[model samples]
Target: MSHPQIRHELSKIETNLRIEIGQLAERKQIGIDSQGTNLCELIALLTNAALSDHPLFSQLTKLDAAFCQLDIGLYGLCSDCESEIEPERLILDPVEQRCALCAESYAHEHRHELRLTH
Candidate 1:
């Protein structure tokens, strides 16, 4: 994709993520009490936990760093191999830092490390 398109998409993603995160923060502060039953309370607690550790939160954090890279004109390059990432992949996830091959390789290595540790 062109630089302008990438910037536009990233800007939109950044804005949406910020808005969602702010809403989540507000909900967290107010607490998610159902005040119905024990099951309801448990469900609320679990939902809060899930949202707190949600992958979207991590993506937002990564996107913040990605924006810095975008400012430097380096956003689309793989962080591991420094190759140009696939445009389709970027459209799917603007926060992605590595190409598919590199990401697969890293995941494989990570799994191996986890196995060894276990």
Candidate 2:
């Protein structure tokens, strides 16, 4: 996708994440990039560790990693296959980590392992 499109998607995801983080943290932090780090730290401290088994924590961790990938110019690439994820999918969900094929395969293999606990 074009840089502008990427930025649009990123901004959308950032906005959605900011809302969630704002609610989860109970205090909104201003700014992007830097605030992602700060909010992650605050969320982590709130989670009090041992949250890898939790889905929301995992999603936040993955999105935080996505911001790191963006910093390194690898944001939209699949983690398993190293291929560029479909542009539409990325635009729809900028935090997505896998291409369609890899995602399907992963879901097939890991379906039983998927569970969300509150």
Candidate 3:
């Protein structure tokens, strides 16, 4: 279908997915603290990891919004660089906010960057 239609569908999917994840988290917490502290700690760690990655889900939502805008002939316009992104790269990542060159350079600079510091 068209980009606008696809974005609308994606928004619905994202809402459902968020609800499913919430329910799953609730169910996961119902289980008791068996197998000692280590098991409990492990479960907490896993939960933390899941929550940490939740932003990617938000990013997907933003992508859908961008796609909606793109449907009105705004595709390939970089939000960061304010330049036309490559068509080839847009085909690869329709939700991308940066052009290939900018993306690659950013990735190279931040690949080793850590989000959480102890």
Strongest candidate by TM-score = 1
TM-score of each: 0.67, 0.65, 0.48
lDDT tens digits, residue span 1-118, model 1: 7777777887787667655655665676744332322333333453556763665556655676677788898998998999999988888888889999999999999899999998
Candidate 1 RMSD to the correct structure: 9.2
Model 3 regions more than 4 Å off: 1-52, 55-59, 71-73, 115-118
lDDT of each: 0.70, 0.68, 0.56
Q: List the residue pairs that clash in candidate 1.
A: none
Which 10-residue span in candidate 3 carries the lowest summed lDDT?
31-40
Pairs clashing in candidate 2?
none
Q: What's the distance in Å from true for residue 50, model 2?
A: 5.7
Q: Following a full C-alpha superposition, what root-mean-square deviation does model 2 have from the true structure?
A: 5.3
List model 2 lDDT by residue over 4-40, tens digit each.
6666666666666556655654443433232446646
- State each model's C-alpha RMSD to the native: 9.2, 5.3, 10.1
- Candidate 3 versus truth, CA RMSD in Å, comes to 10.1
Clashes of 2: 0
Off by over 4 Å in 1: 30-53, 112-118
